[model samples]
Target: MKLYEMRDRQSFGFSAENPSGSKGGGTRGGDCEKLRPCIDIQPGETVTLCETQGPGMITHMWFTGYIGHSFILRAYWDGLEEPSVEAPVSAFFGCAYDENFADRDGNYPVLNSAMVLVAPGRGYNCYWEMPFHKSCKITMENRGAQAQTLFYMISGWHGAIPENSGYFHAAYRQEHPVQKGRSYTVIDGIKGKGCFVGLSLAAGMNGHNTCWVEGEAKMYLDGDRYPTMNYTGTEDYFGGAYAFGNDVYQHRYQTFSGLYTGLYAILGDTSDTYNHQKRFLLYRWHVKDPVYFDSDFRMVLDNLGWTGPRYDDYTTVAYWYLESPAPTPVKLPEDGEMVMK
Candidate 1:
């Protein structure tokens, strides 16, 4: 169908105003009435955001309020016992580490991309189309020490799901001070057929080095011992070269956010801890160039630099789509392990 084309389909949405997503829902509320604008989740509590029968595609999602690692986000498709998607709320949207959210001056990071949009004031939005044949479920777990307020909306269209449509999945991984002389595994233990679509990399140099972006991205597909694909360097993989093309004006390495790739967040000696090191947040979406695999896949990045292997603190969120519902390989770490100071 072209723009302005017509099709027989029904639209629905879930939110605090209308938890059921029923037809003519939220009609009971009035202008500025704000009868039910949000929900609060206490510590150690899990809230089901959306749970409904599906033969539909989830088109968009918007979330705010305490939008960081304190909350865990998970999604299940086709009534699977295991969630196909799991990760911290922040990393799923390309924001990782505590210092990357904002500075003392209140300058929020911005990422204008084809799949995600992170606006000021902690607005986290995703445009990934998640299709389910039988049912779909999305939940949030508050792992923080205090209660958290969540404002959200899940919207989509009811239609016939294609037989070959893949289910979306995302997982988070964090390693403080990567092992010396060893590469950090971005993602592994991937089984079945799917395409790796997006990646979020948050890094801080634990040891001295000219830069931490010297690592090379390697991908092993279909049980290959060696990598079949490689990104020359970390910067090159993010569409930058020679330390992200130095910005003479600011007297620092340039940072930018484009449609599919970006170095969006930068923290310089402002962290509560790790003050001696600098941290950077970057993202890449394989929207135009997806990594398709039939059997299995794995991706790793070497922590190398000018001198030699440079151990660093690294974290990431890997996103993909598979033909069937499957849980991510990486398990969510404990709260103490996920925190970044």
Candidate 2:
């Protein structure tokens, strides 16, 4: 893997030709190197290396947070010159939060009432993939006074999908208003076998008190009816977890004769720890049917040990024929098993 490292004040230039001399006449010559685009990242900004590509181009990103403050990352491609994708600065899946105010530890069963953003002084992570464009972005922010750290990894995939496919699906830990209560949300205008399947746990008070829950949410395969998931409080599933910072995983799937996109997340949350609210993580994979069933998929959290939660949060995994030539096949483990870093 060819990985590029970027930090504050660092600028990378992409151009067409050499900048030394021009070809024609006395008019100071046109610099052969036509400037592609200048990715100007501010003090706390992260961006992709390049946006435009022929096809089958995948971009990967990894980020580490400093102190406890929140940061934002963005990616842009297609219609606009500027990157349009944004995400938070912490190791969590969505939004960013304080690193102090008590519930910051990685081991907590329930989140603090304030961290849920139910009232003032609370916020959630934001991630988006622009419609009609090949771009993605993540942003993180801490609404409190404390500082926090965050890590992230991003990748772009270049593959051909079946024709007639017009929708994309994604999964992530939904930040709710309470620790033990059940919350349900509706995904608007989606059709197909799309769903959210994963485990929810209460990371209680700095890894002290913790609990577990399991459930799944789904929508239709065609662009027809909307999909929804109902979380029950009795199931012991609440809040979210931090997996591998904020990550992006996209795959192409097929339904009957139509094609669709599937995206899901297994995330961790620590918004209700004892020290302060900070960090979120995610683990994701793209695979086909039999291979997916034989895969060992698991979720792991850092700093805090597993609190005996038996909920397996694996979303719907299926197969879809591609419209373009198949790329190199990447083999996945029979059983989905992931190790914590």
Candidate 3:
């Protein structure tokens, strides 16, 4: 069963022959200006971008100064609207290069950083690999400065599938901007363990803080389902560890033995005033356990031997299990390729 691909923007509409319709079907076409390298997904396989040509893999996506843009990759399983899994593209995880602030209306300062430029000729490219069974749709929207022009160069694999149950891992280089206050980024919060990892520079005790908030990523057990977990920490104890703050103040111990979801980052207090590019990086991991603090899990930070901010470039791997058998097998195209019509 190969995934369906519709080239014509109008093909997204409803047709008796095509029940599922097209991507963003019945919605405003203007919302998504279909670019090139459109792809179809296969169940349980990996997609490699370097194997193909054209904009199939994204090299660079540029937004005009002060304008806000969002790129969403959605997966549809069994006619569902929202993707079973989704991740946003931004500077928080260091996948982006430049960062600048904007007012409520999304306008930027006059001396803002230059636009992200796509390499000349044909070297621009980006790749997305997957390890689950799903149908995917990638959408990029310019929500701010409607008239601004955006340029995105992509080159890579198209709709390849992964053989396991993991998601795509993204890494990139980023150039920090010289702003008056500290900048923050959100790294991964889509239905997994609520743990988050963050990195930041030190300025003073005033501008140092780290936290993990929980609202989503709850899993079902045999008879009991656990609620979300929230934890916060600062540089106060053992340099920095974990703490608690929110509606209630209580110690919530967790085990990573089951499914989890959450986001993590380091935040600095600029209101009280702190100067200096404090380079610090941290990671937050959240897990749900029936037994609070019984299980012992060690947190290890491996230095892959890179320069710059210690947290600038790092990889996070997690381990969990599902008691049930594997998910249903997804159909693949007859030609052993994604179907793009």
Best candidate, TM-score-wise? 1
Write down the TM-score of every candidate: 0.94, 0.33, 0.30
All models: lDDT? 0.85, 0.26, 0.24
Runs in model 3 lying further than 4 Å from the true structure: 1-80, 84-88, 91-128, 132-135, 154-163, 166-341
lDDT of 1: 0.85
Judged by lDDT against the true structure, how good is candidate 2? Answer: 0.26
Task: For model 2, give the 10-residue run with minimal summed lDDT.
Answer: 253-262
Index of the highest-lDDT prediction:
1
Q: What range of 10 consecutive residues in model 3 has the weakest lDDT sum?
A: 332-341
Instruction: Report the lDDT tens digits of candidate 2 across residue range 1-341.
Output: 23474322211212122111122311333567434211223443333333443222222333334412234333333334432222233222222222332222322212222111111233232222122234322333333234444333333444442333222222222222222223222222222222223222222122332332233323233332332222232221123222111111322111110011111111233334354422222122122211111112222221222453232222111111211222112222111121111
lDDT (tens digit, per residue) of candidate 3 on 1-341: 34495432121222222223334433233545543223322333222211121112222332222212133222323233433322223322221212333312233212111121112221112222222233323333322222332233222233333343333322221212212222222221223322122221211121222322211222222223332232222221113323222223443312111112221222322232445221222222222232122112112221211121222222222222211112112221122111111
- Root-mean-square deviation of Cα positions for candidate 1 versus the true structure, in angstroms: 2.3
Worst 10 residues of 1 by lDDT: 245-254
Query: In terms of TM-score, which candidate is stronger, 1 or 3?
Result: 1
Q: Which stretches of candidate 2 lie over 4 Å from their true place?
A: 1-49, 65-69, 80-85, 89-176, 179-210, 214-286, 289-341
Error of 1 at 179 (Å): 0.8
Q: Model 3, 303: alpha-carbon shift in Å?
A: 28
